[model samples]
Each structure stands twice: as structure tokens, then as C-alpha cells.
Target: MKWVLPSLLFSLFFFFLNCTDVDYNEKSVNRTSRKILIDASHDGGVWWSPQSGTYSASLPHQGKLMADFLRSYGFTVDELPSFSVITDSILQQYDKVIRAGCFGTYQPSELQAYVNYTNRPTSLFLIGEYLNPAQIDQLAENLGIHFQGIYYGNLDTYAPHIITDSATSFYYNAGSIIVNAGTNPAIIPLGWLDGDNNKPSLGILQHPFSKILFIGDINGIESLPQPLTLKIFKWLFG
Candidate 1:
């Protein structure tokens, strides 16, 4: 709640940047060119913090990294506002919608809009600390996805982890999932809250969509190296 001012400011700034000169029609009509929208707007809290303070909401690195990665991937990558503004018209233009970083406190209308987007046959890559209970439930209600609560201080205890489950194929050496470059049906488990915290795991989902690969807790904004990010961009839209 206290981070409202900077978060709103950042969101407004993002909305204007995309709305002002972005020829959505032109971008959408490029049938051969795949498009992906990276929601790098960081208005959420950190691992230990419950709310991202006003001063900490300006996470421009997320936009910078994702845009570069998608571009390299040969996809027409556009950084969208929060999922709240993602309407049918907007959804038609992009192939994948990546919720990068924290999905913090957004307006009710925006949340409703995002829920509708999830209902359709679309792809969403939710990274980092996901969101709170209400937003998580909204995704499940619309897209049939749900997150398990994270154990408190699990990250500290289980340092450098990796996922070896057959259902969830990952490539990283540490964390719950690995970062393989294959087209496998995987859900990269990212964040988790304590039983008492009970928000949602970053990688759990009810819908078993193909290509649902999650690279657990790797803050594409804070962690991914710039070069690897470029590779990801090239793979998406470049």
C-alpha cells in the first residue's frame, strides 16, 4: 500500500510509452513475425518485503532485459502495462505474455481484464514473487492455474537448487527447475511463500499447457545475464 505512488507513476509512464506511438495494428498484422509482450512493470514486493516501497518500484532493468531478449529471439517484443489492460484486442497482437518480476497491487479493473485473458488459449510466464492471494485466485478462476504456498526461509536453507521431477523438467543446476533449451512441457517453479504466508508458488498451475517452462526464481530483471537475455529475446521475437 505504501508503494502506491511510485508504482502508479511507473505504470502510468509505461502506459503512455506504449500507447503514444506504438502502432499496434501494424505490429499485430505482421503474421509471420511472432510477437510477445513482456510485462516488466515491477510494482510488487521483494522476497523478504511485503510491499515494494515507493522508491523501490522503479525497476527499469526488467523492461530493459526482457525487451532485449525477446528482440533477439526474432519476435516483435513489446513491454505492456500490467495484465489488467490486456484486452482481447491487445491479446490478439502477441503470442506470449510474460509477467516479469513482481505482480503487485493493481487496480480491480486491470485484474479483471487479466483474468479474462488467461481464460483464452494463451501463454503466460509468471516470474519472481508472483502476486498476492486475490490475483493468484483470479488467474486460477480464469486460466485454471494455481500456486502452492512457499515455505518460509526455504530459499536460505535450500541454496542453489534444481528441479528433477519428471512432470516438471528444468535445466538449472540449482533451484527447483533447470533452464534447458528444449521444447518440453515444463512449469518452472519460481517463488514460494511460507505456509503462514500463503500467497502462491511462482510455478504451479492447473492447466497443463505445452511449452509451459518455468525457470524458478530467476528474476529475469535482476538475475539473468545480459547476454543470455539477448539470446532469449532472439528466440522470442527477433
Candidate 2:
């Protein structure tokens, strides 16, 4: 009876030690509750815009890599119908939007819907590129940010911001940005391309309600490290 009782105690202790506590939670980006919408190009996905046959970006895979990266984390990502018009209801459902203006035409109402979305505390990642500046402008104009011409590359130049410490140098072909005066005064310029007159390659808007990380290079998004990308998203969502 004495041996039997000791054996039972030992078995119980081993079971408790070996069992995994599935109930415990790890500290991570609180992004699982936030929903993301990828509304890029005129098509279904973000991969359609800002492309040149391996020549445009540092290494061109377009938006697919970014979309995959975001999803690799637990964030919920969705695509609007390529032909679908953006509306208040749709935008409201998403915590953030990832946009690459390549060939999409935003109706006046859709732009207004975005205005409504941003009027609240919403965030966005606006992708930029050298090609189709006009098309990119259509979506960005609503936010009073404009994407301009090209710059070959930059070794590294960063503003004092959260994502700056996450990466060493930006390695992609990027475009320039001209942020308007009256808009998000909390503008923090992120990176620059040094080839043509120190053109700015990235901009971040850190307003209380409207958080935007405007990436001026389509290929730049493709080249971003996952930790850096998550940090950028966390900042935007925060």
C-alpha cells in the first residue's frame, strides 16, 4: 500500500510537469483583433501595381510578398472586389488598409468613404512607386500626400521614429513624396533615396486618429523585414 501511494504521487507530478498549459498567452503585437484590408490596384490583390520586369524595385515580387508577410502573423487580411466600390460599411469593418495605387479608379463617393473612415481613428499603409504616379495620386490626394518621381536608392537616412531602429538601410528603388502643409502636421519623414537630390522614400503620419505609413517605393514594401513591418503596423494601429 505504501509503494502504491508513492507511485501514484510520482505519476501525478510527472503528468503536471509534462503537460503544456494551453491557456497561457504570450506577449505579442495586439494585432489579432485588428482587421486589415488590402485594396491595391484595380484588381483583386496588391501585386498588380508598381512593376517593371525585375528592374523597377530592388527585387520585384510586387505586393504578394507583403501580403504573405502580414498573414504570416495572425492578422486578418481581406481583398475588396476588384470591381467593387469602397464604401463606409466596408471601410469601417477594417482597422487598417494597405493600398498601392497602380490602376484603380476611386469614385468620388469612395474617396468620401475613405474620408469618413479616416475621420475616425483608422490607419493605412499607402504604397508608392516610380511608375503610375498619377494613378497613385488619386488615392493619396485624399490624405493630402502625393507620390512623385523616382530615386535609385539610399544607403540609409531615417527620421527619429519607432521603425528606424528595426532596419539598417533601405534597399529598393523608391519615389519621392510631397506632403501638404495643412495635413497631418505630425509628419515624420522615414527614409530617403540619395541618387536624385536626396528624394524622400518614406513618410509617416502620426496623428491621433489618422495613422499612415506612406511607403514611396512599391518594391520597398516587398523588401521590408517582417519584424520591421510588424513594428510599422503596430505603430499605425496604435
Per-residue lDDT tens digits for candidate 1, residues 89-150, read 76556557766544444456555666656565656665544333354423332333443222
Residue 22 of candidate 1: its Cα lDDT? 36
Error of 2 at 164 (Å): 0.8
lDDT of 2 by residue, 66-118 (tens): 66666656566675434567888888888788876545567888889878887
Q: Could you estimate the TM-score for every candidate?
A: 0.44, 0.70
TM match of model 1 to true structure: 0.44
Clash counts per candidate, in order, are 31, 0
List RMSD in Å for every model shown: 17.9, 8.4
lDDT of model 2, residue 28: 41
Worst 10 residues of 1 by lDDT: 156-165
Report, for every candidate in turn, its global Cα lDDT versus the true structure: 0.42, 0.63
Clashing pairs in 2: none
